[model samples]
Target: MRSRVLGSVLFGLGILALVFAGGLAFVVAPAAARLPYDMERTQSVAEAPNAQFLQITNGVAKVDTGTLRSTVTVQPDAKTTADLEGDLDGSALVWLVGQEVVRTDTNEVVSAYSTSYAVDRQTAAARDWNGQWLDTGSNRQSVKYTGHMYKFPFGTEKKSYDIFDRDILKAQPARFVKTEEVGGLETYQFVQEITNGRQDLPKDRLDAILGQLMPGATSGSVAYANTRTVWVEPTTGQYIRVQEKQSKTLVGNTGQSVTLLDALFTYTDDTVAKSADAASANRQKLLLVGVWGPLALALLALLLIIAGAILVTRRAAPTTAPRHAHPRHAADEDETAPIR
Candidate 1:
């Protein structure tokens, strides 16, 4: 009975410990993932400016890890342009310009071009733009344009002032599908389509448009299929979210493609402008999923420890006698022993 009682107590303790451990693990697993998420979020916020408009003049690009090392200046000005000097690799310079995009190497202008617009500051619609470049030494010029907007509420427009033969505008249609919580805030998701190789757009015109758009939508890898997603903050109208994805080739080697899955943009509004804490809170929630794994493991370990403790206590429990006891007779033993 004593052993049983002890065992029961130990068992209960063990169960409690196990429960505690499980809870701890559950909490820790998510916490670990959050470490990376938080780091990324903090880095992104730090790299980006808090004002309505931001400008990065003479921006320096780090080779690996894709972190912005330094910027010439940042302010709340509406129109901002920056001259970027870096080694040409894929699409790395797309995030710096709003009007004209120029690619230079070793202090020499390799290509000078402009982007056409499909949508303006206000009014939700689909917009496309192309890129046009001029040959400084030789008066030669090239233009590249790509496909029509298959999606709805989309339109195309172009502005050309140079001596280029053709005008190319990057054609992308933006539609306000719905409001979603992205990076922890309610954001409007916009879908943008680019000219796939299967479609027929003038190669020169397509190239020109891509050139203009490339600075804003930089590619991650050399493989053409890797595309980046850009989001504009609905309240501030400033880009807040940028995501990149890897693409797999379905057919021939040259038939590779990159599809934009998700992009987020935020606009300046009273909420974002008035409170800095709110913005931080939103970022934390969106990144919470990354830390859940560590929290779960910690909880599991705690549970096991609790179970072991309960078993140990059960083994250590002392035996106890019953309240009632029967008396033994020595005389009966003596009588029985006489025969022996």
Candidate 2:
């Protein structure tokens, strides 16, 4: 009876353990995959040396050649997070991005812009929960955003993924190029080529450039092209390093054309190291909840279940009597019968 009761306890414990394992894998793991609300803001610095860009000063535009330094930052949007409800699988991640480019030689500000958008907590895909807004110094507009932006999905695969380009305002395929390692972590390299994608400039801005670059020409536009490459840590879907080969040319209706911007921007070494460290930390947490923890619990449950089955199915050995033993009660009975 004691063994059976012990067996029942062990059996119950095994079932409970199994349930916990399932919960860790299915419930806790998914929750862990969601982006954290207090995520760290990103600070990235990159530079392009010996590059060509347009310089506008005192309402006059001119093409110049120099080094360019760019600073990009990403942080959670406070207003959007407050607006989010109990939807989106309990995740309310929205990001505000700012980019500023300046001439390294003369410290002239070349380009500056800000953008705000929403992305899924799990997949990092663009979400329309809030409106997408872009603000340049000249104008601000509401634009539709799609596909991957600053981040990638957790547990990213080796296949192609779509990443959005700010210039074209569309998502393009980022094809898998090769496997490489960054700061001792293996990563997948993806490349995206935008062949002469058109960027529609504001009419006033376009006219101003045309007036300065091509005199007496009434119409012109800028043709944009870029070769973007990224090295992504697979497990955490964090970018380790990035390189952008960008070129922009102004074409006038009167058969005059000039290079507006030509530069190759690469993330600095310090930026890459910091990004790698963050990715590694996140990867460990995800693996523990999703893979290693579940596996260990399942194995323990199997052992307990087997031990319980043995105790429950087993029977105690029967009691044995000695053959040479004689009872005192037998002698008393024999004597009583003689007297009778």
Candidate 3:
């Protein structure tokens, strides 16, 4: 009776454990995969003014260009607004607003870029950077951030992407060049290379535009290229640091490439620190939900199953016969022999 009761208790506990494990594996785990995506992320980078490009006596010289700062805001797109409530579509939208200030004057609008992306809510892979609200040039097809938004399951040997260049006004390839540490977090470094790419303007049109900036008479087509490097935290898919090396050149009738504007952009130290903290926290949460927590639950279920099996075996019927199986068999045989 004790064995039977113990077996019953163990069996019941084993079933409960299996149910819990199943719940965690099938239901809770899937929910956790989508957790990091449902929030609004706002980040701002400071661009300090430098005197390096101020005195260029080439195609374009800065007369009174002041400090320029840009703000980028990203958010989860609303379903109703996008008409993407169905199973096949989801999006994240961002607004890029740049402001320039001359000395102590109020901020003046420099440029604005609005981008929408079709991203998988669960996986965080962006399928497409759908529409551009205010694209300044005709080469709209070459835009950046086209494919997967974040590195899903991030550890990659090389991550490749195509991003739109604001300088060249086209999309180009950016690939992982190396890995480095930023803000106490290991990160992937990617570079976007553009070399002497054609611009949307005609030669005469470009000359007309450059005539205003340059002090001398210029005649030729204008072309531009840029190199943008970024350090991204893999776990959270956030950029901790960024650098842009851009230059515009005017190819005169003599095929000379004169540098018009050369500028570099970098992120503030505080931005890297904040991004690192957020990424570290995200890594901890992913480890708990996707790795350690499931492992623990599986271990508990295995233990319950083993205990139940042992108790059930103990409660099973005996397989062997008794030693004194026929104690009365001798007497019955002897009585039968005498009567014969």
Candidate 4:
């Protein structure tokens, strides 16, 4: 009876443990992705070596390039894409937007632009934010620019990814270069190159835009090339630090390439430090939810099953009843009367 009671108790506890683990995985843990996300980004710009003409005094060109301030925000959206149903087996959606305002040293806003993306809840992979479906193929390249920089469950070895380019509306290849430490957090280094990015602008329109950046510049068309290096934390897919060298080249009617805009940008030190803290915090949460929680529950269930089996086997096994001789006196009397 005691064994049965103990077995029942253990079995009940095991079921509860499994239920709790399932709840943590399916409900409680998933809410981590819905946290309000915002970041203040800054990029400092300077003239590249190839930049020439104008603001030249005594062989020193006075480049007026300064800083670009960008406000990036990611918010949980009420709407979700149909593909959201397939995101790591159903995930929430978020809307990410970034606006960059380029300012001169004198604090004049020279140019501004904005971009938006829809991203997976956990992995932050790109999706069709517009809710429009396309037959472009099952294995569509995803953008990893916002929410998270790299896909979740990052690999240890070198991996190449086709990152989506919003401006060009295509995917560009980014390859893992190495692993290093950024602000004390281990990171995976990735390099991406862009060449002749197609903006679909008309030749005249391209010329007009170039003219604004560089006076008296005549071009048949414009092309863009960029080399970006990013250090992303492997556990959290956070961008700890990033560097970009982008050049806008104008191709003359004569087929000559002229460098229009060449600038190098880096994330501020403060940004790197802040991201490291955030990554550390998130790593703890992931470990608890994805690793330790389930493991503990499984172990508890196994123990309960073992205990219950032991109790059941004990009850099922036959027990021998002690053998007893017939009463001596009764046996004597029966022996005498049995002769008849």
Q: Which prediction has the highest TM-score against the true structure?
A: 2
Q: In candidate 2, what are the lDDT values of residues 1-340, reduced to their tens digit?
A: 8898888788878888899999999999999988888887898888999999999988889888989999999998866777776574355477899999999878889999998888788888888764679998887888888888777889889889999999999999999989999877899999999997988899999998988888888898889999999999988888999999999998998989989999999998998999899999889999999999999999888888888888898898778966657667766767756543
Q: What is the TM-score of each candidate against the true structure?
A: 0.25, 0.89, 0.69, 0.64
- The Cα local distance difference test for each model comes to 0.32, 0.88, 0.58, 0.57
Each candidate structure's count of clashing pairs? 73, 0, 6, 0
Cα RMSD, model 1: 20.0
lDDT of 3 at 184: 88
lDDT of 1 by residue, 1-340 (tens): 5555655565565566555555445654333322121111111211212111112224321111111111111111122111212321211111111112112122222123333312222222222233323232224344343322111111111211111111223444333445566555555545443334232233453343333323443222221222334344443333345433322221222333333111122223432342334344533443343234334544554565565456555545457966638666777656756643
lDDT of 1: 0.32
lDDT of 2: 0.88
Query: What TM-score should be assigned to candidate 2?
Result: 0.89
Candidate 3 ranges with C-alpha deviation above 4 Å: 15-19, 22-27, 35-38, 48-68, 79-82, 85-87, 90-111, 122-132, 136-145, 148-157, 201-208, 215-222, 251-258, 315-340
Model 3 Cα lDDT, one tens digit per residue, 1-340? 6776787787777778777777776777666655243465556565646412323234444433455554555655555235554454433323332322122134544434555545555545544444433343323343444444233333333677666564455567679899898888888888888896765554554665456654355666657677878787775566778777766666665555555545566666777687688778877776676667777877877787788778777746788977875467666757756642
Give the 10-residue window scoring lowest on summed lDDT in candidate 2: 84-93
In TM-score terms, candidate 4 sits at 0.64
Maximum-lDDT candidate: 2
For residue 247, model 3's alpha carbon misses the true position, in angstroms, by: 2.2
Model 4 per-residue lDDT tens digits across residues 133-189: 211112233333422333433322367656655445566777999989888888989
Lowest lDDT 10-mer window, candidate 4?
132-141
